[model samples]
Target: MILTGDIGKVKTLLALFSQEKEAKEVARREFYNKEYASLQEIISVFLKKNESPLKEEPIFIVCFGIAGPNINGNCQIYEPDKLDWQFTIRELRELLTANYVEVLNDMPALGYAIPKLAESDLVSFNPNVSAEKGNRAVSLATGTGLGELLLYRDRSGDFLPSPSEGGHANFAPRDNWGLEFLTHLYSQFSPPISWEKVISWSGLQSIYGYLKDRKGVKETDAVKNRLNREIPHEVILDMANQNDELCQQSLKCFASLYGAGVGDLALRTLAVNGVYIGGGMVQDILKKEITKHLFIEAFMNAFKDKEGFDKTKNFSKRNAAIPVKAFINQEMVLMGALQRARIMANLD
Candidate 1:
């Protein structure tokens, strides 16, 4: 007998289901150049490649948006554009009876999961605020697209997940150099590339493409070669380390804007309590560009109303008594997902 699992019956999101090897080696080489592709196409490509011969056990699928905090398993069916506003359990039950549905904030899961991966305590901070207590953790991933998340811990030794559409937040440029970079970026993309657009992995291409277009170098070949040969994070850092003029300027634009964006989130959430920087790109920055004094300088550059903001800056300052640290928990998202799953299962 064939038994079908109710979509809502899923306890937790198992893991991101994209065909990894296929995505990197095959799908990406074949179909990833487009701006966006249908979900069906993505699923079809993924499923076609992973042909596992096994019994058709009743399986639960947990789904959530990149920015959604809640882990409702039914977001897939509602079809609404906004993730937070998507369908709830009641609606999902209308379609399937045997399935379970869960909703969770993606960022918190990532934040919580990092600690699990790293097997250590984590300090997570993201641009968006989750209502949970304790320090927050946030990250932005740019492999296939942008993913923004928040991580928090409560008194019960549980991670409270929160998610944000922060990657879509407005871009705030600092310094004349930043202004120039933004201007150049805007002139190229029709809708205009925001910080999220410029800072992500794909965004680096956007940056390189924009630079080439504005400079009128007629070197699409050279730019693509750079992307294929070097990751943006490495290229930016290498340029900075070498102190090349254009590379320095590009990195300066990136660092200043990035610091400001982080500061803004810090202010909004009063993350003076704690703030962390993670993501594939941040790893490169910390390894290459981060310094206490310079970090503080770039961060404070955005506080326009100097007096109170300045005072608060001191209070929230990263210092010896309360130092800022990396997430340390590398597999945070997976752990968080499992924790959420366990909670959903009501395990002891």
Candidate 2:
């Protein structure tokens, strides 16, 4: 049996895998923690639930796709509103008692799984923009935090995934509202604000705060109660789906900023093949009417909005025509981790 994990800020995903008599099988579970609990605690709770199966099957390898940079087999995962935590591959191997352990940045893991995705796993945002063959691709995930990665075909005609800290890049405001939003964020946080501050779960909450404080929007009792009880990001989405005016506007703003970030990534990477939008927040929004209209409009328009660069109109046009997709497979990161583990063990 193989153990795979995708550790992030809001949720830690775990999958137990085994080869069945006729096919490969996997069982998945999620651990939600506000503080992004220690890895030992997470694994302990997971093992408690799957004790019987674990006792019967000897785990072969463990692979973890964590939300942060993996430097020299060491990772320092950054959590929103919490201190960064460190994890090393050597320590992980000893703790899990596994023969091998692999740690990778979460976004690159999603990139690794892109080629393996089925047609049903994707929701095309721009069907008219056919993906160019042999071109590069980018994956941007917005969740507890934002993650970005680039994928290009190598000399051997195989896709190679590279992780990036692009999410930490400075946020560029395109309009008056964006400028005001940046000012509001600056008031709340320190200098050098990044896209992660505006496009993540906490980012949504920050947007909501700005809307409420600066725009003087009113939140209904339902929204207030939900905000007090559940995750603010979830609450905002639910309220938006329920047609709450303030929440709707907040979501629209978030969508636009998200689109802008995507456009920037597309331009930076020249990802002509596609730009994949993944993560829990995007998945939630995709289920709502907002994604069909407001989100796509903002995303497409931002990609083509090169008002100041009249000479680079063609570049904007090219970007506008780039294939943008929403990845619906929530297990993509885990699948990628598993695939990488197989590759590492020479089992694939």
- Which ranges in model 2 have alpha carbons more than 4 Å from their true place? 8-23, 26-61, 75-87, 94-100, 134-141, 216-230, 290-292, 307-313, 346-348
Maximum-lDDT candidate: 2
Cα lDDT of model 2 by residue, 64-121, tens digit? 8887778898887776576467778887877788888888888778887887889899
In candidate 2, where is summed lDDT lowest over 10 consecutive residues? 19-28
* Candidate 1 TM-score, true structure as reference: 0.56
Q: Write the per-residue lDDT of candidate 1 for residues 1-348, one digit (tens) a residue.
A: 111111111121123322222211111112231322332343344334433411232223332323333343444422244111344556534432325444444455565455444414533222232332355545464433345545556777654556677777766664565576678767766654556776665555455455556655344343346657777646645554655444444445454565566555555654434556665465554454433233334433442212235654653333212223455443444445554544544442
Worst 10 residues of 1 by lDDT: 1-10
Of the candidates shown, which would achieve the greatest TM-score relative to the real structure? Answer: 2
TM-score of candidate 2 against the unseen true structure: 0.80
- lDDT, candidates in the order shown: 0.45, 0.79
Q: At residue 144, give the lDDT of candidate 1.
A: 30
